[model samples]
Target: MDDAYDELLLRGRVYGADHEDPGPRPGRAYRELVGGPLDGLLLDVTGWDAEALATGAALSTHLGRHGGEGRSHYEPRPTDPRRWDWTADTP
Candidate 1:
């Protein structure tokens, strides 16, 4: 499981699951690195204080990373985060 996903859950920030369709990804995966695990990160900071959210919402080429699947007691999780990112992000 990706640490980012766990961190999101720990803070109760994740809102819902949005999985990528199955397919081959060209170049770098937008949500996850090529073949990276996680359908993609979907953490919402809408409940967070303005300061906290703004700090993480910076504009940068290195902003996107891998995450999406949950690994809690009943959360939907993939076998690996590295491979999960390989799936298509959209249909």
Candidate 2:
């Protein structure tokens, strides 16, 4: 998995699962990149829930990289979704 994606998963483990229909959280970072103020914007997940988006954005910002700049670098190698263990039988 990409480093950033791994990092996100780690954060998710530490934080929590993303809420369904993340909404404007992803778009907020996109807008910042579109405005050209974000020279190194990276979007790890093109589509993510609000919680995931918020967590990613906060981490990226603190790391001093634009939220969009790391998208391509990390998204291609997504963490094994199965690792999340969200199965119907799990409950």
Candidate 3:
């Protein structure tokens, strides 16, 4: 066992087995998704520009609002730059 192994165990303890592991995202930028089917998930926007960030994105998720796979739309909140508000869902 080495430092990587120790980090793996630490990640499991921090995020649990079911939750997504949001470990050190070096050089990667992300925004917290709020509401909709993808709540509590981080949306990676590493290479997005200001225009792209403003336009938002449609994220695919297996947990649809009506109970099937669908796409969730999210837009950056006017008040918060680090969070995206879930606006709608389509199955």
Candidate 4:
């Protein structure tokens, strides 16, 4: 287990697997990724019944400064006011 954990950490550091940017320190990267206004919703996974504490620690470790960089593949849609129609919004 220990060896696996160490290997994982090393891989994370090397590839910035979880946003572990090579230049910055780990704590700063973590805070930048996990913090900010959306932090509440992002961090609140209670409904998933997941292991919050352990997950947090692991994230803090493997994510380094950037926080799970390649783990997520979401791309933000282009922001165009015309794309939204407040008059007839539907789910």
Candidate 5:
């Protein structure tokens, strides 16, 4: 499985299983990516510190360098809560 799917399982978030819409576990917070390669993917920020949460993270993606792989950089939007805006892609 890919990193994202693996992460979901690791977070105990099962889709189409016992619960129809098993959202993020209680106490788990997430930020949704608004654009770029990983758009619409929910980023779990349950335990992220203030600095890290504000700076966002470099997420992995399968679309870069001849369509092999790459990393997408995102940062929290100034006016949006629990949302990250795509900045750019990196090799």
Candidate 6:
């Protein structure tokens, strides 16, 4: 819980677990470091670098557009973004 636990706590306290902000979620690095389903799903976004930010953006967009739309996770789909409430419905 050392990695960004403070951030999560703050979010939970302030946002009450319903808020969906892409800034605080644990990245692939933490997941991989621990090794689990979380390793995936999330891209390794340790530092606030450009690549990490891009990866996060791609992850959010992909999850929202493709995953949210219920498209096959097998075949890659284009990122057709729409204004969806990720706070209530996360992909």
lDDT (C-alpha, whole model) for all candidates:
0.30, 0.30, 0.68, 0.25, 0.69, 0.28
lDDT of 3 by residue, 1-91 (tens): 4575345333322211235654535465666677887776666677899998998888776676745467888999999766789899887
Clash-forming residue pairs, model 2: 22-50, 41-68, 41-69, 42-67, 42-68, 42-69, 42-70, 43-68, 43-71
Preferred candidate (TM-score higher): 1 or 6: 1
Stretches of candidate 2 above 4 Å error? 1-39, 57-91
lDDT of 4 by residue, 33-80 (tens): 222212211221223323432233222222223453413211111342
Off by over 4 Å in 1: 1-39, 57-91
Q: Using lDDT as the measure, which candidate wins?
A: 5
Q: Candidate 4: list runs displaced more than 4 Å.
A: 13-91
The runs of at least 3 residues in candidate 5 whose Cα sits more than 4 Å from the true structure, single-residue gaps closed, are 1-23, 64-68
- Per-residue lDDT over 47-86 for candidate 5, one digit per residue giving the tens place of the 0 to 100 score: 8899999899887766633244678888999997566888
Backbone clash tally (model 5): 0
Which candidate number has the best TM-score? Answer: 3
Of 2 and 5, the candidate ranking higher by TM-score: 5
On residues 30-80, what C-alpha lDDT tens digit does candidate 2 reach at each position? 311211222323333446775554333322222223343322112111343
Report how far residue 90 has shifted in candidate 1, in Å: 30
Q: Across residues 29-90, which tens digit of lDDT does each residue of candidate 6 receive?
A: 22111112122232233455644333333222333344544321211112411111122223
Give the candidate order by descending lDDT.
Answer: 5, 3, 1, 2, 6, 4
- Give candidate 2's total backbone clashes: 9
- TM-score against native, each model: 0.21, 0.19, 0.69, 0.20, 0.68, 0.19
User: Which portions of model 3 miss their true places by more than 4 Å?
Assistant: 1-24, 66-69
Regarding lDDT, does 4 or 6 come out ahead?
6
The candidate 3 region of ten consecutive residues with least summed lDDT is 8-17
